[model samples]
Target: MKHTISALVKNRPGVLAESSTAFHNNSINITSISCGETENMEVSRMVICAEGSDEDIAKVTKDLQAMDFVIKLDDLARKEFVDRELVLIKVDVNKDSMSQIMQIFEVFRADVVGMGQKTITVELSGDQERVEGLIKILHPFGIKSMCRTGMIALKRGDE
Candidate 1:
């Protein structure tokens, strides 16, 4: 099963490394992770996605919550939340293919952020499904390079 764990930690150096090391030592496979400062500048929130059995997830959660820097922890996988990811992809292009690629980009609502002699770079942000859909559709165009920001999520409703 996949699990999303959110942790609030003090805004200090090495916190991210420590947290990741804990997960590594526990044998958790992190598929995605993102962190940024919270409303309180003194603290930061980390959203992490990992795959493991329920028992394994529970153990890691417990261990993470016990860390000195972790002020709070939430198992977002079990809650209703909104998640998103951002990706930038560069695809090979030519006069003949440029128009076709632009049409496809319009269909996906992706923006052409850069253009080079033989390639066009696109930037897209949305849920995992939407991003994956665009990538699948553009595969035939030949992807030169791509980069993705891992999933970031927040709970729904008033918390």
Candidate 2:
């Protein structure tokens, strides 16, 4: 099963390394991870995605919560949450293909952030599925390069 775990920890050195080690020791494979400081600069929030059996994920979560730096842990996979990912793609473009590419971008609601002699760079921020779908559509245009951010999520409504 895929799990999205969020951890609130002290903003200090070694917190990320320690938490990652804990997940590693528990044999959890981290598919994605993103961290940033919260409004309180002393605390940071980490969002991690892993694929593993329920028991294994539970064990890893338990271990993380036991750490002194860890202030909270939430298994977001089991809750209603809002998540997004950012993707940047550079696609080959020409006079003949420019209109088509623009149409594709419009369909996906993406933005053309840069233009070069033979390529146009598009930026998109959305859920994983939408981002992946846009990539699929852009593939035929000859993708020169692409990069994606790790998924970041927060619980929906009042938690």
Candidate 3:
């Protein structure tokens, strides 16, 4: 199973490295991770997505919460939260396929961020399902390149 976890840590230079090392030490199998400063620049939120058994996830969560640098920790996978990821994909294009691709772009609400004669780049942001749907649909267009950001999440309602 996949789990989403977040840790709030002091926005210091070594926080990220140390956090990741802790995961490594615990043998936590991470799938995606992202860290960035919150509105208050003094703190950073690290969002980690990992695959593990229930017991393993519990251990990881407990271990992460006990870290000195971590101010707070939450297992978002079991919380009422929403998450999104951003993807940029460049696909082969030509006059004959332009309209079809454009239609798909509209259907997916993807933006044309960059364009070339032979290829066109698009930006799409959504939850994993929506993002993966777009990529799967665009596969026939011949994906030239792609970039994706790790999932970021916020809980719903007031805490």
Q: Which stretches of candidate 3 lie over 4 Å from their true place?
A: none
In candidate 1, stretches whose alpha carbon ends up further than 4 angstroms from where it belongs are: none
Most accurate candidate by lDDT: 2
TM of each candidate vs. truth: 0.94, 0.93, 0.95
Task: Please identify which of the two predictions, 1 or 2, would achieve the higher TM-score against the true structure.
Answer: 1
Query: Which TM-score value belongs to model 2?
Result: 0.93
Candidate 2 vs 3: which has more lDDT? 2
List pairs with backbone clashes in candidate 2.
none
State residue 94's C-alpha deviation in candidate 1, in Å: 1.6
Model 2 residue 81 CA deviation in Å: 1.1
Q: What lDDT is reached at residue 73 by model 3?
A: 92
Weakest 10 consecutive residues, lDDT, candidate 1?
Answer: 58-67
Tens digits of per-residue lDDT, candidate 2, 71-90, equal 98889877899999999999
Q: Assess each prediction's global lDDT (C-alpha) against the native.
A: 0.91, 0.93, 0.90
